[model samples]
Target: MKQLIVEIDETTEARIIIAAKTAGLSAQQWLKRIIDEKTVSSWPDSVKALAGSWQDVPFAEELRSGEGREKTY
Candidate 1:
């Protein structure tokens, strides 16, 4: 197998570690499984605050109905 080197930020490295632990795997194994096209056993645990009011029931319903969902960043 060919060896590859990847450079990432510290935050990303931390996330990788979290993801690896979530799947009960080492970082190398996690990356290898990803490269092998296996489904990720655990998702990365990052939370983002969505823009919405607590009482915005209508807006929440609209969002859930696929009315105002963003495709991606």
Candidate 2:
């Protein structure tokens, strides 16, 4: 319910109009949807499952402590 004014190149403006028409949305609505998609962030279930998964991996603490890097350099 807020108003915004943005200046875009003619080519970009044309592309937005075409895409919005193709998607059956107004250009304003299309741009708002695009912004909403990009601005929201959430971790997926698969990634959340990875939490603490590394704890049981062999030598995880050694690797995290830079043991290999000290030996190589």
Candidate 3:
């Protein structure tokens, strides 16, 4: 695996350390988890589960089809 180097202020470092300790992880593990979350390639399960839940909402194609729109020109 490749390695990364970062520079953070002391206050930020202290905060990270404290959060890691609270979560029972080392600073590196906590940071890695955060990076993974931020860089995820797919929608989260909670968001995906919301699909088809709104029946009244128009799909993108329908909204852009210009139906019922008043022509100004």
Error of 2 at 29 (Å): 0.7
Q: Model 3, 24-61: lDDT tens per residue?
A: 99999999999898999999999999999999998999
Candidate 2 minimal-lDDT segment of 10 residues:
64-73
Worst 10 residues of 3 by lDDT: 62-71
What is the C-alpha RMSD, rounded to one decimal, of candidate 3? 4.0
Please provide, for model 1 over 1-73, each residue's C-alpha lDDT reduced to its tens digit, 9 standing for 90 to 100.
Answer: 7899999999999999999999999999998988776665554444224434356466655667865667775
Q: What lDDT score is found at residue 41 in candidate 3?
A: 100
Looking at candidate 1, the ten consecutive residues that score lowest on lDDT are 44-53
lDDT of 3 at 3: 85
Model 1: residues with Cα > 4 Å off, grouped in runs:
38-73
Ranking by TM-score: 3, 2, 1
User: Residue-wise lDDT of candidate 2 within 1-73, one digit each (tens)?
Assistant: 7788898999999999999999999999999899987887987788899988886676756668865465644
Model 2 scores what on Cα lDDT?
0.87
Residue pairs with clashing backbones, model 2 = none
TM-score of each: 0.46, 0.58, 0.67
